[model samples]
Target: MRFGHTFGRWVLDSLLPPRCMLCGEMVDEPGRLCAACWQGLDFIAEPLCPCCGTPFAMPVPAGMLCAACLAKPPRYRRARAALVYGRGGRDLVLRFKRADRTDMAAGLAALMRQAAGPLLHEADLILPVPLHPRRLWRRRFNQSALLAQALGRQAAKPVLLDGLERLRPTPSLGGLNRGERRRALAGAIRVAPGRRALLVGRAVLLVDDVFTTGATAHACIRALLGAGAASVDVLTLTRVVRPDIV
Candidate 1:
């Protein structure tokens, strides 16, 4: 079986050489970036907030939370993201979400899997931040669900695609304050009726495309906890980091 699979792959590769996902430069594997594009990615690393995983400007003591986190904590116990939503990251996300690049799910999920760090190990199940039926109908797909499914496959974890539901459709949240975002999203998310019982005592890992403000993720996490989830962590494709440029 292995030999046949290898031979098939060899034939396919010979017919169509792999190229970089970003620049289209030849590479050894599909759904991967060449050296330049890979290095261009700002992967989150150490010296970050233990709670939210926001990269610190400089080295800090262990277990130190960022100022924003310390003043008003997020609902998720911990969070991590693959890239700072800078030029490169933003381009990747836009192409994936808006340009019919669902094929990038595996590549982007691989990136998130790397940044997941210890979060994946502690999580009992993976859930995507769902879209409202209206939005789902318009968009035709939930990018977050795609990421969650791909990441679950790579991590060998069970993905509950319908674990949560968006109760209503929200307008564009741009230019809204944190408080405003919270209000807009209040009562807009809940654990799926069918999954509520199964979530009890489980540690959930919520997946999303981007983390701009904690409002959306917080609402989802709160619902998970309210449904009896023991804990909730978050993993995102990219995040809006501070100007400090960690």
Candidate 2:
């Protein structure tokens, strides 16, 4: 029975062979990442910034905060990120964004699950920061919603895509400092009517693909809190941290 099952599995694999999304290398697994590519992926490990959860050289102890946090703390109660947005990390995100490689969303969400782990148990709903209707029409999909749905499946929570609405299309936050980013994103997001009760007095987990300046997430958190959310936690697949610029 075991050998028969193994042979059947091999036949199925041969019919639908797995391949790495980044390198196109044939893989032995179902997902897009291969063993070598997975090993090369740089994950954010320890000694991270408490405010935005970016991996740093030195640890910022509990209750203590990083310079970024001291200068301008984000609205969310806490944030966690899986990897730094550099090298293959940036490539992965851009590929998913511009190149239309929607398959990468699953791989990225898996990475977030690993980062979030048991923290999934702490949230009542998984909310994806919505995109403006104009942008959504152009892209035909919301990356954050894809991430939230993927995470919700693993976390066993209802991924709420319409929990918040983007009222306007905020300018790209590229090359902006914390203050500028915050101002640019302000008034861009709000809790949707009727849906506000879903988060009232509940712990909400905001999901996004990347944490750059955290402008978008902060805006979303502020709106959710205003709608009576007891607390908000954030999770992103990756974070952009350029030391030379920061």
Candidate 3:
């Protein structure tokens, strides 16, 4: 069996040449970035804001919160992201989300799992931020759902794909400010009917592809809490980390 597996891998590599996921440069393995691309990514690490997981440039006292979190705490208990959403990271996410690169789900989930740390162990269930039916139809797949499923499998936890539902389709929030974004997403999401039981008194790990201003995550967290979820923690593949905040 081992020999057959090795032979199969050799055959596959010969055919596909193990190109890098980001740059398409030939590499040692599939689902990996070239060294240059890897170095270009800013992986979020320690000395981050305890509340929102924003990376701190300079060392601060442990358990310190960022200015934004101090001003307005997010609805979720905590949040973690694997990468800083910059050039390479943003391109990778956009490719996965818009280019039908569902194959990238596993690799992205692996990064999220690493960033999630204790959240995975503490979570009672995994839930993906839902896409409205209209958007889902247009996108063909909810990228968040795909990531949640992959992460749940990695963590050996049950994924509740329909636990939360987007009740209405909102306009693109790309250029909206924080207040506008919040208002736009208000009452746009809810716990799906008949799925609340799974959430009641349970700790949920809310999964998403990217964390921008977190308006979407906050709305989902509110809905999950209202459905009797004990708490919600967020995990995302990437986040926009601002140096000015620290």
Candidate 4:
């Protein structure tokens, strides 16, 4: 039986060689991504808002904030993304979330490490936005948690998987304006028991796969602050840029 199992594994390996997650060219390792697609990532860098992490062309004349942040500050202290959600980056996120590639989570997490290493070091606890029980049952996995674990592995930080909980199910936020999305997510998150003390006077980094209208991250930030988190930071694989660049 053991010999049969070993032979079966060898056969499976031979039949399906590992491929790059982006272009599907057979790679030396299954989860390995190709150099072209990797380099194709346009990472967000300097001259960013000290609070919201929005990249700006130049530093604000006298302030630490960006124009969008001046108009409306984010709930979290600072947020940074690995890439602007465009063609190739967005395609990878979609594949990871919807197609169950799972492997893509590691790739995204690696990019995030490059984008936000210092932020990870300041964190006392790492929390992934929780999926409501119903969604968890259906999906059988939370993409945020997967990203968090991969990050924890790389950074040697303890990932508090059970520290946050979604209080109830939320309907899909598709087609909703920012305000509508905020209202939908209101009162949706809570800190788990006995874990609240860990956040006191400690910097917390909320992990999520994407940052859209900022509604989801804001909702989680409010809950964490209410639970006594000294401050909150957000890390995401991609940030959605609005169309019609003016």
Top candidate on TM-score is 3
List, residue by residue over 108-200, the lDDT tens digit for candidate 3: 898888899888999999999999999999988899999999998888999999989988999999999989999999999999999988889
What candidate 1 gets wrong by more than 4 Å, as runs, is 1-15, 243-246
- Deviation in Å, model 2, residue 165 alpha carbon: 0.8
Off by over 4 Å in 2: 1-15, 59-64, 70-72, 242-246
TM-score, cand. 2: 0.86
Query: Top model by lDDT, which number?
Result: 3
lDDT values, one for every candidate:
0.88, 0.80, 0.89, 0.82
Model 1, 1-246: lDDT tens per residue? 646865776677558977777787999877788999888888888888988999998998888888888787878899999999997898889888887656678999999998998999888999999999998887778999999999889989999999999988988998998899999999999988888988999999999999998789989998999999999999999998874432
Model 3 accuracy (lDDT, Cα): 0.89
Ranking by TM-score: 3, 1, 4, 2
Q: By lDDT, highest first, what's the ranking? A: 3, 1, 4, 2
The window of 10 residues in a row where model 3 has the poorest summed lDDT is 1-10
Give per-model TM-scores.
0.90, 0.86, 0.91, 0.86
Residue pairs whose backbone atoms clash in candidate 4: none
Q: Write the per-residue lDDT of candidate 2 for residues 1-246, one digit (tens) a residue.
A: 646865776677568767786787987665567777777777887666665666666655555666776787778877888877877777777777776665566677888988884457889899998999999888867888988998898778888899999888988778899899998888989999889878889999999888887778889989999999998999988887755212
